[model samples]
Target: MFFLKDLPTRQMLQTYHERYPGMNAEAVAEALRLLRRGSLLMRALEAYFTAHTLSQTRFLVLIVIDREPGQEGLLASAIADRLDISRPVVTETVKALVQAGLLGSVPAPGDGRAKRLTLTLAGRAVLADLLPGYFALIADFMAREGDGTA
Candidate 1:
């Protein structure tokens, strides 16, 4: 079976030239490279997360809550804002983490309706366990890129 990365750049340029006529081959090649790299990184992350029984969003939420200072934790809205994602998405992710016992929520001191999220012991432990490997993988990738082998 043919793979995207297996396709030669010259062949890609020729195919794009045939299809789009005036399309810029250099721009198309760069975009294809970026897309392939993104796909590889995402698949790697997905596999890692799946092995740990964690979703990327849930892991991100846990990290956000864990990084918050003091014992009060953070609001779901705050997480949404920090992650630049929608409130509903944060809410759903928080719900899943809470259900999994990885997160705890309490009513905000001044606001009865607002809940502040905090990482549970399990959450902290999981993050601590996974972070070393995650950091190592990133470091390795960076090193490879630095050596022009990526």
Candidate 2:
């Protein structure tokens, strides 16, 4: 219930300390440390994606497209649902990717009203170039700090 960053983390959580005397504040301290670590890691990933001509949202769109049926791709509505983002946001991302020559949109093979997205040669190359680093970051983080190995 604490803001968690209201106090310099080296400072003990007074609420936890005072609410239950003799109970060590180690739990609160550990939680704070984990939160800070997760936050910084997310920031680092965001920066890496941004600097490399990719955004996580759009990258996710690409991933969905690759994973979906036909490797042919899905409609914006399907992508929005799969990514748990807004339809409008998905639309914009698809447009940008299409413009960047990373994605191509065409009439859905079965549905005239919907557009199917497919990655182009350049898109595949971009994904190939970016995936190794992204996987490395995840692997390194989990290897070093993740608690659940099972």
Candidate 3:
């Protein structure tokens, strides 16, 4: 969330360069512009996820499972690791997903205490329904970037 709507002006950055030796005004300005664009993209994604009744993490969890080599799913631990998030966070989200009938857990083979998480029919349908809008959002954003509007 780079929330600085008004990025520093070139003149301001040039003034900063005078006060701070070795400061690159052009580089700094370019970096800020990139950050602002990234922030815009993230905000768009956040809004999209919210409309879908999901957070970024929740969306990612579903993606991680869907992207696995087989239609078969991964363990909660594996998902957490892949997402670089904590176990409890993954567990909590998974619990909610399961409760919503979007996910299912079965006892892990050869590991009675562990569970493997899989997408339910509803989950697959949700992804099928949701991805077009998601991809379109991405394409729209990238198109704007390509047009130098970002």
Best candidate, TM-score-wise?
3
- List model 2 lDDT by residue over 41-93, tens digit each: 67667788999988888888888887775876678888888888888898899
- lDDT, residue 106, candidate 3: 91
Candidate 2: stretches off by over 4 Å:
1-34, 142-150
Winning candidate number (lDDT): 3
- By TM-score, the candidates rank as 3, 1, 2
Task: Write down the lDDT that model 3 would get.
Answer: 0.88
> Each candidate: what lDDT?
0.79, 0.79, 0.88
User: Alpha-carbon error at 7 in model 1, in Å?
Assistant: 5.5
Which one wins by TM-score: 1 or 3? 3
Could you list the CA RMSD of all candidates, in the order they appear? Answer: 3.6, 4.5, 2.0
lDDT of 3 by residue, 5-124 (tens): 999877889889999979888788888888888999999999998998877788888889998998668999899889989999999999999998989999889988789999999988
- Encode model 1's per-residue lDDT on 9-97: one tens digit a residue: 67868887999898988776666666666666666776788899997778888888777778789988889888978888888888888
Which pairs clash (backbone N, Cα, C closer than 3 Å) in model 2?
none
Q: Poorest 10 consecutive residues of model 1 by lDDT?
A: 141-150
